[model samples]
Structure formats: C-alpha cells, structure tokens
Target: MTQSPASPLPSPEERRRLREAASLTQAQVAARVGVSRETVRAWENGRTTPRGQRREAYAHLLASLAEETAEETAEETAEKSAQQSAQESTEETEAQNATGGRDMTVGQGARERADTAVRTAVPAADPTEVEAPPPEARAERPLSPAQAFDALYAFCAPALVRQTYLLTGRRELARESVERAFELAWQRWPEVACDPDPAGWVRATAYDFALSPWHRFRPRYRHPEPPPSNASDRALLNVLLELTPPQRRALLLYDGVGLDLPETAAETEATTPATANRLLNARAAVAARLPDLSDPTELHYRLVELASTERLRAAKPAVVRDGSERRARFWTRAAIAFTVALIGTTALTLRTAPTQYEPPVPPGETVLGVPPRVAPGPLSEKEQKLRAKLRAQMQHGPERLAPQPE
Candidate 1:
C-alpha cells in the first residue's frame, strides 16, 4: 500500500507574509535556532514540519515576531503623531503672531488644550521622569552586553567585590580581572546575551586571569623565613595547594563562587548531582587537613579594617608635628645614645684602673720586727643600706622599687 502524503504544514505564502510583516528573513530565524536556510525554506514551503522541540520553538518565535511587528507599527504611529502635533503648534503660534498678540490669550488657550490632549495620551510626558516604556504587549528587546553589565554592576558590586577578593586575594587585581572579563563579554555580546548565566562566564574569566603568570609573580620580595615547624595554617595552605585542579574548581564554585550544587555542576561541566558530590568530597578530603577557616563575621570585620586602613593610607594626610609624638621620638634617640655612652664609659673606667702591686718591704720596714698583713675594712654604711634595700625588694617581688642610695 502507498504511504499517505504527510499532513500539510504551514504554507509558504503564510510564512512569507509573517516573515515580511516581522521584517525578518529566513536566515535570521534559522540562525537563532541553529538550523540552515534550506531547512527553513522547506518548512515555510510546507514540504515538512519542524519536528518535536523545534516545532514548539518555532511557534514561540512566530508569536514573538507578531508581537514585535505590532510594537513597531505602534512606534511609527507615535512618531507621526509627534511630528503632526509640533507642526500644528508652530502654525498656531504663527497665526497668533499674525493677529499681533491681540488674540494671544485665545491662541494660548487653544494651544494649551492641544497640549493637554497630547500629555494625557503619553503616560510619562513630564520632563523629570523617564519617558514611559512601550506597552508590555510588545516583545522585549534583548539587552546588549554593556547594558547588562551596567545593570549587573548596580545590583551586584557590593557582594561581587567581596567574592572576587576572596578568590583572587587582591582588590586591584580583582578589579582588573573583572574589567577584562567585561571587555571580553562586550566583544562577544551577541553570543553572551543568549547565555544562561553571563555572570558565571565572567567569574570563570576572572579566575583564569587571576591564575595568569603575571599576577602570580606580582609580589616581589624575599620574605623573612617562616619559623621552623609547620603551623596549622601553613599546613592547611599546603593541603589546599595539593588538591587537583578539578577539586579546587568545585570547592571554589560552591564556597568561593557561592554557587549551589546545580550551578557548580553547570560551571564544572559535570553531569548529575552524584558527580558533583564526588568532586566536592574530593575537595573536602584535602581541605579537612587545613585549619578551620575563620568565622565569616571575623573575616568581614577584617575586610572592613583592611579597607579603612587602605583608605587612610591612600588619603595620607599631612604628618602633624605633635608635641607628644615628637617628644617620644626624641626620648627614644636620647635613651639609645645614653645607653651607648654608659657602656663606653664603664668599659674605659674598668680598663684604666691600675693593678694593685704590694712591694716586698725590706726587713727595716717591719714595725717592731713584726710583719703586718693588709687587713680588709668592713663595708660602708651606704653600701650596707643599699644591699639591705635590694634584698628586701627582691623578697617582696616586683610591686615595690628600691630607691638607690643618694
């Protein structure tokens, strides 16, 4: 038996009319939905119907096209109205002038009536507020990348800066990375506008920029050597570094990027929650060795402190010549000099003392033929008193100071 001919699809004539009314070509429609020009022609010619998902998409596209067409017509009508009203107003003013301002009141009244009529028609004709948006019945135009960036910045910059700094560890570097990502988005605006999560793309781009060689080497210094024996924080930092690239990616997605599991999956190109779970588990295995991250509140306070300090540094007000500060510095220098002088004088005094020499006396020098041995004198009263005070003060501990003997 012969197969019956396929049920008729939308006619070429109908499709042509719709496309023409919408001011769209076949190629444009095909480009949007990832089809070829020939396929679009065949569908329009009723040779075949777009199957399954494509048919649904096509129907939606056609509806959108119809709405756009209606909106364009409305816009054209509004433009024509504006032009006509302006011409009439000019003509009326001329006529009033011709009447030598004698009918100025009457002419003004007529013009005011006309102006009111126009004002009432436009929803937001006031000079202060923005012009009223086109009716919602129209298809909304897609935003360009620059426009989207502006809107995103207004909504997200506060949170974004924190998030970025957490990931990149440098405010200036983060800003540069974000700006570069936006520049890339602007260059590929056509593709970017259709992306499901444009912000995610920017985040990824920033991550890549943060890892660039130039950024990695930006710090140039020989740090004082770390104390021997691993600190918990240093150990944890090492563990974090040991993680595989993918594990690091997942952790950052959820923890750093603040993405949920589903978003993490999307960013990592993994399918299923199970896969994402495995990735996260792997990351946790590495991270468990790390010191517990500080509390969020503490971190926030730290950021505030850092930002305020940086701002103060940047502002760098003049260093005032305050009496106390100056005195403290002068005293510090004086104390250092006094210490050096005391040390030098003590050394010189100790070195210059003569060595004691007992000359052996001849037999004639002995008194009453008896040799006299040198006898040691008892300690002086002042020395004995100072020693007693020091001993007492030592017994009493640090609370009391013993004054030196006058």
Candidate 2:
C-alpha cells in the first residue's frame, strides 16, 4: 500500500499571523502550550520547528485561535457595517432637511437681488455684463470639540500606530502604544483639542510608549503579514532592523511618517541636527545595502506605504470608553493605603520598642584607666653615640654615601 503523505506544518509567518490575529502574546501562547517564550519565538523566527506532541499542540492551538479570530472579525465587521449604514442614513436625512431649508431661503433672496441688479443695470449697461454668483452661504460652522476629536481619531490613529510599528518593529506593541496615547487624549480632550498640533501630541506620546523599557518585559505579538520578500525590500528591512533604535525611530518619523526634521526631533527627543544626522546615516546605510535603487525617495515611499498598509489593517477605531482614569484612581488609592500602613507600622514599632539608656560615670573619674608612670634609665655609651650621630644628621646634612660627582 502507498504511504500517505504527512500533513505539512504551517510556515513561521503563518504561525505568527495566527498568534497576532488571536491577540495572544508569545508568552501567553507559550504558556497555553506548555513551552517557554523563547521556544515560541524560535518557532516563529524559523530557528527551530516544533515536533511530536509539541507540534500537535501548537497546531491545535493555532487552529482554534484562528477560528475564533475569524468569528470575531466577522462579527465586528458586520456590526461596523450596520452602524455605519445607520449613521450615513441619519446624516443624509439631516443634510437633506438643512439643504432644503437653506436653498428655499437663499434662492428667494438671490433671485430678488439679481432681478433688481439686472433691471437697474440694463438701462445703462452693455449687453455683455454678467452678474456674479451670490457668496456661498457663510462657510460651514466650525466643528464642535467632540466632532473635531472624532475626525482627528479617524485620521491620525492608524498613521500613528504605523509609525510606532516602524519604530518598535512589533505590531501589538505599536497597537498598545497608540491605544494608550488615544486614551490619554480622550481623558484630556480639552487640552488635546486646543493644542496647536494635536496629532503631533498623539504621535509623540505613542513614540515615547514604543521606546519605553517596559516593553522589554512585556510579551510580544507579531505582525499579521510578513514583510515584503523582494530582494531590495528585504535588504532595506534588514538594514533598518540592524540600526540603533534612535536611528530607526528618526528615519521612520521623518521619512515614513512624513514628519519634518524639527517635529521628528521633538518626537525622538533629540536636537534637530542630531535627528537630521540619524536620517542621513540611516539613508546611507540603506543605500549601501540596496544600490539597485536609483532613487532614495522610492525607498521612503515604499516604507511609508508598507507601514501605512499594515497599520490600516491592524488599527481599530478609537472608542472613548477607556478605563484609564479608573485604573489611575485605583493605583492612587493603593499607594495611599500602602503609605498609611507603612507609617502606622513604623509608629507602632517605635512606641512598643525599649528606650535606649546610658549609664553615668562615677564623679571625677575617667571611664578608662590611666597607665602607671615609669622612670627611664640612662642610655649606654654605644646608644648615646648612636643618638649623637642621629642628632648630628638632623642638624646637618649627612655625609654622601658615595663621593659627589663634582
């Protein structure tokens, strides 16, 4: 009988995408599968492949997670579509009503005015005189704060997440950073809305979070899609990965995110000159690696598009239901309680402890005993001659051990 071919294992990229789509961090997935995080990372990086029971477990886990993720995505998409349809319907209704009312009022006034002008001008004017259109009904009113924030969130969140992903090279970390920044913005809407560059504030905050050391200990998730497999793109990504974090961040912010030198510098917390230098070095390094690319701008545009596409796929719409304030309050209360407990414990220990005491010395007596006085005997003749020689040496320079070179 012919042997059946064994089922092929999933590719590393497939595994990574499944893990991320399920929102499971490497550590979390590892724990579920009874493996170390490093092992999971190794599997994802193609350093090693799972086998036997481990392989079975990994496959099963991924299958379940992927299925769940698909279901969730479908549900979310359907809900979003329904909500969007409803919102559009409402907006269309409002627009029609407002337009109808405005047209009725404005059309009558414009017609009357135009007629009056035409009649007056017709008597003395040339036949070629053309009437100007009435000025556009006063420009649409400024957006309210809530409307402005919604607009900003829709425009800025995806790009911010993308820039952060380029900086950190991790999808979940980028998402977390961007989400945290938006949470802060939601909490301080007034301040954020009034800021000169509200998007800048959000981007800077996300960048800071992406660079935070806390991420070192936090579990990591992968991007849903693998990077481009083309030689030039691969070379560029490899060079970028090799660069220092500051250099990578500078390049991404300036080229990928389209931030200016000063803005990039501010986001990276470096001086403008330093940021410019980093960009120059990063570009030179990429060029050296991929000399086939004639135009450097092509690389920048490619990276920007890559990051933007990934972010657009990954970023969810920002909702203002963040519980950050509640978390902050809880931490604050916990700290206060801890401080009070520590203080009370210290006070109680002090109150219950024995007092230190010192014993008094007897009146007119030293605490330590004094040594008995002793009489010295006269020096022997040889000792006296030695002492005399020492005194002579002290009083006058000693004779040279060897004759002076004079």
Candidate 3:
C-alpha cells in the first residue's frame, strides 16, 4: 500500500494575506489556532514555523480561511474595482492591526525577562516608557550579533535610561547604570542572545545596577546630581527618591516603566503580594505629595515626561565592547597577580621555616650538697697576741728574709 501524501498548506505570506484580506486580528487567529498571539505573529511574520499539532491546526485554519477569503474576494472584486475601495479597506485593517500590536507594550519577548528588565535588565513596558514595536519579522535575514546589539541598544537604551533615572533620582547614575548594563550584555552576548529575552537580561542588569546601594558610596555619585530644571519634575523626583529602594523600584517598574505586577515582582525579586503592596504604598506616597500622579496611567506619563528632562545617550556598541574587554582583562590580571602573590608567600614561608625543635631551659634550683654558714667564734689568746705583734711592727718580708740569709 502507498502512503498518502499530506495536503499542502499556504506559505507564510499567503497566511498573512489571507488574514489581512479577511480583516482578522492576530489575537483572533491565535485563539482559533490554539496558540498565543505572539506565536501566531511570529508565524505570520515567518520568524518561525508551526510544528506538530500546532502546525496541523494552523494549516487547517489557513486552508479554511484561504477558501473563505477567495470567495469573498471574488464577490467583492466588482465592487472593489468600481469604488477602488479594496486598498483602502486593507489599509484600514492593517492600521487597526498595527494599533493592536502596539498595545502589547514593550516586547513581551524581553518582558519575559522582567518588569521591563534587560528587555532594559531589559527595556521597560511602561505603555509610556517606550514606543510599541511594529510587526515582528519584517526582515528575511537574521540579525548579526553586532547588528542585533546595536538595534536593541538604539531601541531600548534611551527608554531604559529614563526608567533607570526614575528608579534612581541621579542623572549621572542613571546613564552609568545603563552603560554598565549594556557593557555586561556585550560581554555575555552569547548567553544573552540565547536567553529567552535578551532585552530583559540587559534591563534586569540595568535595574539592579541602578537600584544598588553601592552606587551612593562611589565618590562620583556620592553627591546628588543637579535635579531637573523644572521644579515640578525635581519635586517629583525627590518624592520618588523618598520611598525605600524596594518600594521605589516597584513603583517605577510597574507604573513608570509599564511592567505588569508579576514582571515587576520578578525584576524586583519580590512576591506578587509584596509587589502589589509596594505598588500601593508607593502610589499612595506619590499621590500624597503630588496629587497629579495619583493614577498609575498618569504616573507613567509623568515618569516619561520627567525622563525627557534629562537626555541619556548610551555608549556606542564598539565602546561598550571595548569596555567589556577592558574589564575582562583587568579581572584576568588581578586573578593572575593574586595567584602569584599566594605562591610567593607560600614559598617564603617554606624557606624560612625552622628545621629543628629545641627544648626550653630548665629553671635554676639550690644544690643539695652545699654547706651552711655558722657564726664566727672568738680568736684564741695565742692567735690574738701574734696578731697584735704583727699589727704593731711594720715588717718587710723580703728584707727579713735577706737579713736571715746574711
């Protein structure tokens, strides 16, 4: 028996054309196809191909949709030609889809990393933080490492700098934090690229760096930079800085950067409930001081506007790469020096070590045989007379001996 060949499915372009022609949204297509909208978008944009069950379901959906679109197109052909309304209708639907896509806010791919981490750790998702991306996979060629890094930096750096600035009320710190994060990203490009969300990785690094307490100790950042020229912005920043770092981070990630509660939690390394509390407390604090920012939406817009007060430009890709390499080299040299010093110290210790042990001297003590002293007795009479005679006469021993000899 011969095996039956599987039925053919439409091309990616055909798939997209059919959907557009039918005025179907990606979310609608995804729902019918048993997948997420991103997955459907990826497929339509030809970034990936559906597989196994998803592939089968997608193929069927496309085939059915294609047949329907064909019939509709034929019926509408005369009317469309007469009114030249086909293009207009397609354009309107495309515009609608574009608007819908923009609503996803900050690439979910990156937010898959954190409240907008690296997507600033990552770029942020503040609906107001960064502009919504257009359709994914508009290009056929995969981005080179350099290209990808540059593209990500250009798209997310400014927004992240803004987000980081809001997180930490220092302009220099905000810029440095972002640059350092990108430098780290460049160093770990392989891991970052392979990560599910590269932007989030960079963003998380940026956020963590920005929120670090160590930054304040740095001489350069020990003092606060000049606040925004606008008194309102300056006051708002001061109010934001007043919140504890955790609370401040939660607020910035959630309200300022547009990261959802869960993403904020992940980025901030807190539980969902804790994150929610932080948000509430932070929001309340801001509202008490600045009533205009009571609403999260308003707060987000305000944060964006405040960020515009300071223009943050990230280091170029080449500069970041160089900095990363320099750091790597410095660490490498430090490690080598440490190892060498340890070896030398060990060698010196071995060389100077004592070869033999000597016992300590014993304490002195009295001798058992030593005689004891007694009081002197009176001299004998004869001895006394001799002594008195010797004392009275001055006698020379040599003269006396010579006289005796003569």
| Winning model by lDDT | 3
Using TM-score as the measure, the top candidate is 3
TM-score of each: 0.32, 0.48, 0.59
Question: lDDT for model 1, on a 0 to 1 scale?
Answer: 0.59
In model 2, what is the error at residue 148, expressed in angstroms? 4.8
Ranking by TM-score: 3, 2, 1
List, in order, the clash count of every candidate structure. 0, 0, 31
- Report lDDT (Cα) of residue 271, candidate 2: 84
List, residue by residue over 288-322, the lDDT tens digit for candidate 2. Answer: 87775436578778787667555334344434423
Better of 1 and 2 by lDDT: 2
RMSD in Å for all candidates: 25.7, 27.9, 21.1
Query: How many clashes (backbone atoms < 3 Å, residues ≥3 apart in a chain or on different chains) does model 3 have?
Result: 31
lDDT of 1 at 14: 68
- Per-residue accuracy of model 3 over 8-41 as CA lDDT, tens digit each: 6678888889898777888799899876665676
